[model samples]
Target: MTTSKTEGKQCNLVNHDEIWKVHINMELESAKSWPQKWGFLTESYNQAMQESSKVTDRILKLELPEHLRTRPPTPPEEYLETTQAFIGWRSAVPGLQLERYGRVQCGKKSFLKELGWALDGCS
Candidate 1:
């Protein structure tokens, strides 16, 4: 009976170890993609900022009638906010060392959720 109990405990321990390994592997894979994801986000925000700038410049240069100018199409507000948020995140993610360790100042899941929100706004 003692031998059976020891075997059962060992079996449970092995399963627990396997679960931890899988979790670590998943985190490592995510870390590997962090740079690529960051690059894509940077490119997206840059494009949005450039487009917003062009629209602002065009509006500034235009000499339309005073009455009609009131209804001019403004640049996308969502993109502007997104660009700003991206700027903050760009500095913050590294400062927090989110990808460097399993845990950091900001929870990884929370950071990913915020990232997803930004991405959804872009689309």
Candidate 2:
């Protein structure tokens, strides 16, 4: 009958609309993860660059007088232990660790004050 055929077409149209909405939602969710994924990738790239710079620094340091070099070349036997220690010793804030290692005591810890100073680093 004509009424039955019309009803079937309307049901198909409704299903297609639902399918479109689901597809859109999936795409939107995937888009949401993109920024977080890029952030992780950026952090990874920064760490890699830092490691490369450390190697470059060591190479440049080879040109300096041997006594002035801060890092001594690693001996083979302790390599794994040293690497593990170095890898585990780091936190999100590396500058703080370096400051502590140098015994440079920051008198008072104020997050806002330090953030201001960090922002002013270009100047």
TM-score leader: 1
Q: RMSD of candidate 2 to the true fold?
A: 18.9
Model 2 poorest 10 in a row by lDDT: 89-98
Candidate 1 local distance difference test against the native: 0.67
Q: Pick the candidate with the highest lDDT.
A: 2
lDDT, candidate 2, 33-97, per-residue tens: 99877768888899999999999988976676533334555787866446556545543245435
List candidate 1 stretches off by more than 4 Å.
1-11, 46-123
lDDT tens digits by residue: candidate 1, 26-106: 999999999877768888899999999999999999798543333333478734446666456554645444366554475
How far residue 96's Cα lies from its native spot in candidate 2, in Å, is 63
Worst 10 residues of 1 by lDDT: 65-74
- Candidate RMSDs in order: 28.3, 18.9
